[model samples]
Target: TGKKYNSAAANEAEEKINIAIRVIADHVRAVAFAIADGQLPSNGGAGYVIRRILRRAIRYGFTFLETREPFINELVAVLSAQMGDFFPEIKSQQNLVTNVIREEEASFLRRLDQGLQLLDNVIAQTDGKEVAGAKAFELYDTFGFPEDLTALILKEKGLDYNKAEFDAKLKEQKDRSRLANEMTTDDWVILTEGNTESFVGYDQLENTVSITRYRKIDSKKDGVQYQLVLSATPFYPEGGGQVGDRGTLKSINETIEILDTKKENNLILHIANTLPDNVNTSFTATVDADLRDESQSNHTATHLLHQALRSILGTHVEQKGSYVGPSRLRFDFSHFAKVTDEQLQEIESFVNARIQDHLPLIERRDIPFKQAVEEGAMALFGEKYGDSVRAIKFGESMELCGGTHVKNTADIWYFKIVSEGAVAAGIRRIEAITNDAVKAHFAQQEKALEDINGLLKNPQDTLKAVVSLQDENAKLKKQLELLLRDKAKNLKGELATELQEINGVQFLAKQVDLDPTGAKDLAYELGSLGTNLFLVLATADEGKPMLTCYISKELVAEKGLNAGAVVRELGKYIQGGGGGQPFFATAGGKKVEGINDALNAAVEFVTGK
Candidate 1:
């Protein structure tokens, strides 16, 4: 049996359904990839990614699949069982995941139902004219309604929609997003096999290396720079948000300055201005010993800080990102809010305590990733791991890492936190330094403090000295305010006498010598005197002209006047624009001569002859 329906409406509905299906399929594939990597459904990076995907899928089903609420749960359960071996945590947390998805789905359905009611209002107000596809798409994108749902509701109301136009708009947005995230890389050239790079420079400063493979790349700022992969280079590649290493790569005859070392794929590429003339010749690879030593100290200090955070804050604190360079180390971790001053002090004290203890660093190579975890080594949240990883431990502080480190915690000399703040929604970051950098940082601080103390005659207590000076400054400020108020009062009476009657309204226009704030206060006081009073004042201070306007409540209604519009129109003369309520407004101008013209315009507006 066939039900008579509009052929166009049916086709539009089918196209929307197809697009939703494609979105759902892409999400499913992303989940499958996460599972293949042995990542579990926990409250971390990969876990959050999976949860977001599942919630989106459930919302899509409610909007487009036209199935009941239980359909998404059933689909997730089926997928979980098929992939349970790869991610046992998914099955273990199935009930929790389902409950979360169902709750989100119910909430979104309620929002959609409310949005449909709003749509009906828009349609009724629009009076049967076909709504633009762009507007309809905006409603869907911002309010999370499927396009099919939009079309369905519009069809029920006897209105037409351009589904193709909506799809085109959607596609354009997707194209822009794709372009923003697209990354390109050139293919790697392999030079040697079985020549794994080592990091002996942590203990020793220099190493012997032969140049392996090198290539040239063109960048926006610097053109035609060479990138070389060396055999047994000592440079550490930048990872976990730290800047790369930079030093000298030299042969006996020629020297190439290494600007940076970074790892791409599994290869460490050394960036330089040019490659050495003899590609096959062996050379000395040297990292800046001072920088390397400082970096190692900071790197180990970060481990201590990480452990301190877990002990003082909670075990929930996980490393989100890190940067270990020659100068400083910046650490990012998962935390919901700002680290309090007391907590930060505690963390600082704890790391310094460990440094004082002189804890020896334990390095283990070629450890199985699973075994490392079983031994309670902390793996970073967003890092992708392989079958094997290197573990570094400073007593209880154990983590899977490959960065260079000091032989003992005492080598750190000192740890100092430079800054701490939020990096993202639930992530906080701490930037700190160690060794010579810490010494240098404190030296700079001491010099500044000395300068301040000298200016204050080297007070016995700096804090009390500064507090007394601040109190005196506040008293002086209060006296200045009182003087300004007395001046304003005198000016107000003189200004009131200057007011003239125009078109049966009290019109006052003048170019005052007062500042903008004073002029505004004067105008407001004048307006408070009586009804139908209009005031406009302009002042030229420091080669700039400022204007202020005020109108009484009755004058605004009688003249149909808007001070905001008047200020906007007058702003062109002054080269600045501003707006305010009908009762008050202001503008600033670069041309001092334009103040008179603006005053004339305001007078004409009030007179209205």
Candidate 2:
């Protein structure tokens, strides 16, 4: 807090220095609070907003403060001390929040150094005082470099760019993004407006209900779609990291497939591609039982997994994000490092042990949020809780959740962690499968083992057989290299006698029977023997043609001969082009028949005919 802040030496401005201090102070609070609430800086959406704020703060420190090292993370302790009493999350998660910011600052500082070099190249290529705005935007879009930072660097060099052009490019990108995600909704067509809708999915999978209202939505992505609201529905809308339920609706006249279920403004909306023939008649709403059961298994497994992680890793671990679906479950949590292979095995074993214990689900339909928390229910930081919350518990694992779950832990036959990795600076993600997915995964693995065994000729010990085969292959490779070298040596002597004198230069152009590597070795060996020598060697291996050219340094300087230029000109015969230094070059092509023609034309470069 006592560090002095000032502008660059060239500009000794007091007001600018003060601005930098205030900017760092204000933006750091936003970053810290957001991280405590489980929002990490990333590349898109709200995550990107946090990232831009942090980078802007770091840029200020780098420019006006003249503080180049990672100093922004140091302010986190002060922020926690001042605001911790009122906002306890910052105090509890101070270390985690600090590390996330520190990583981001270090990463951006490295990029800032690279951006300076890139700007220098851009300035060198510019012939006038102005650089292209498109180039500046490319730095921002492609390389994560700030455009304003580019402008600032350019200004220091007495250069500027057209701001209007950059703004236009930015706007065009925004417009394209909006068009891709935009959708328009019409007013709800009221059918039976007096009846209120209620969700009965927790107790049943099918219920008889009537359409309360309907609306039509149009979007470029998903052309004309309809959303129908029912009087009483048994479909669970997507929320609490669980996917929406899918099923169908049937009336006396027609049947409509419900593609998905979602909630908006506390109203359950059933999405369908077409409207039913009789919206006024009573209909049977059925939720897909198989899909619902699979989702429930995964959703319940997440709770058990959360408990296992906290028990093994530490109490500091908190849920950042999750996705529970019919196929797999992905859980993101805050941790300082990678979950090691040993820890992952323990976590998996813990969850599977709970499944074997056959703990029954203890669900409370409605309870006061305060009372629920007082009873030691784990509430996620970012989620907004109302006056009442639904609590789900399985043995010692309890959390305030709105997602559907299984009746007992035994419903989850087995739990398997397939992968664990880091998604962001301090966030780790674990992807796992359960029930039918675990069965399929093991079956596929067994089949792969069988294939490997067959490839090894059903050996008594598969691993030993594989090791022996690898050793034999290595020995064969060495023998092949020796044979190729001998062949090149034999051809070298025969080709030396065939060299012809052209313009006081020793020249030879021929197609060799050896491979590309052998031809290159033979050309280099012949070139070392004499001065003013020019060589062109061509080889074809499996229908692919390779042309190698080597020119002596004396001839390259005296006769203006370039092996690169020569190969480029002659490569047209084989429909290929390549270039290298003035002394040596190589080209490859698809047309093997053109090898002889390319070799025949090499004499013109030496004779100028």
Candidate 3:
């Protein structure tokens, strides 16, 4: 159902204010859920989605509701108190949700301060009774302000906004996004009576199943695909952090290759290249044994790793998200600080010990969700569960899972942690290899070691040899820095000797052979030593001209000279731009010869001499 907004008020502006309130009420749910689901308000991906939603809601309250300071964070408590019973995850993750929202709110408030000026500019351009959709879009696209915020402001001015035109612009942008991330599908056509599908993939890899439904999809982005559904197949659909199984379906007359198995709202869609010739009859479905075996091994390793993380990084660690494939497994969990190298080694040892023990997986099915929770089977927050769920218990490691796993932990062979680092604000991700991926990993590491040994002439102590080289390089760097500093001190006198007076302002404009930092240092030295000084140091290092301006505090007050503004004007001559405080500024440009002209321009612009 669409979000229902029910608040009404007496004042004319109150109508707009209520609009913002309603939007905020509706959007806060998504923000709350996304945060509980472990997605933070970041600059990209799903976090970007959360950020946009929060900003939109805040923009409404900002424009119409007259809410200036961070107010949406307060509503988090109201949301928790209201819906906490139904969705307890929000209550559990309330602090995280509130903190993320508050941080995002504070950030957008800073943006809104800047955007208000942009909004005014957009509003001013449409002087007529109607604000152009293009103008409304500018406020949103450029400034990141909500469109409704613009509408509310326009309504206050008795101006109508072009919504239909705005929708077109919105659709154009959506089309661009859709094209980039497009997945076309065809309408399903039923071939059998039943709507249910079953997976017997745990016990068997091959089965003869009848086509329940089929569809031919032609996508402009992905091209043509034939999706078929079987009554009861052994194929496992992609879900629960596991990739879809790739296999084939065979009819009596022909064999149709199954590209991938995926689930969309409990419907397992078998993506294929071609349709079966005889849709009425049953066909033999087979899953590639080698692929599922490797996947299961990695999936089991992920479970062991999850337990190890909780043991290593405290019980605060929970599954944030994961990706299990034939090659490797990537596990994301909630933790504050970085996992140290020693901690990772310990984690690896823990998992490898479990693998070495050959712990049997105690697979329990049709277990009541509540009973399973009582049994201490760790349930992933935000994941929807049925009345009865499957729980995989490996000694101490227990989790509610439906994805295929190894019969025993020993099947994983070996576990190697590839990398460990932060994924978000409070989330850490660990990518690790299992089974054949481990063997491949070791092979690559061995090869790299061999290459390094060959490069180092097979040094008996490679670590000590490398350390000695690094020490030598550091000493050389220190010597070069000292030499450069001494050279700069000498060049300062030569540059200062060329000082000339213009309109009672002690002006010096000369081309110097120095790096940017060196040039800046020289300018500060001269400025600190002199009085009534207007210094402009120009340099052309590697044919890139740069200008630095330093004006005295007295002249800045008397002559109204701004060093930043002066350098910016000088920058135009050298095809560049810059700005700074009243006393000091710097600019960089392309034209080498223009450095002298830029200095002359600065003198004429400030002294008119």
How many clashes show up per model?
1, 0, 0
- Alpha-carbon lDDT, every model: 0.75, 0.90, 0.82
Across 291-327, the per-residue lDDT of candidate 1 in tens digits comes to 7777778788888999998999887677766788778
Q: What are the per-residue Cα lDDT tens digits for candidate 2 across 1-609?
A: 344555553454677787889899999999999988878899889999999999999999888777667889999999999999999989988999999999888889989887876676567568899989888887887777888888888899899987888899999999999999999999999987575999999999999999999999999999999999988899999998999999999987788999999999999999999999878899999999999999999999999999999999999898989999999999998888989999999999999999999999999968999999999999997889999999999998679999999999999999999999988888899999999999999999999989999988899998899899999999999999899999988888888899999989999999888788888888888898788899999988777888999999999999999998888778888988666788999888878889889998999998899
Q: Between candidates 2 and 3, name the one with more favorable TM-score.
A: 2
**Position 123, candidate 2: lDDT:** 74
Which one wins by TM-score: 1 or 3?
Answer: 3
lDDT agreement of model 3 with the native: 0.82
* Most accurate candidate by TM-score: 2
- Of candidates 3 and 2, the better by lDDT: 2
In model 3, what are the clashing residue pairs, if there are any? none
Give the Å shift of residue 115 in candidate 1.
22
Looking at candidate 1, what is the lDDT of residue 507?
87
List, residue by residue over 149-195, the lDDT tens digit for candidate 3.
Answer: 66766777788789988899989998998887666666788877766
All candidates: CA RMSD in angstroms?
A: 9.4, 6.3, 6.4
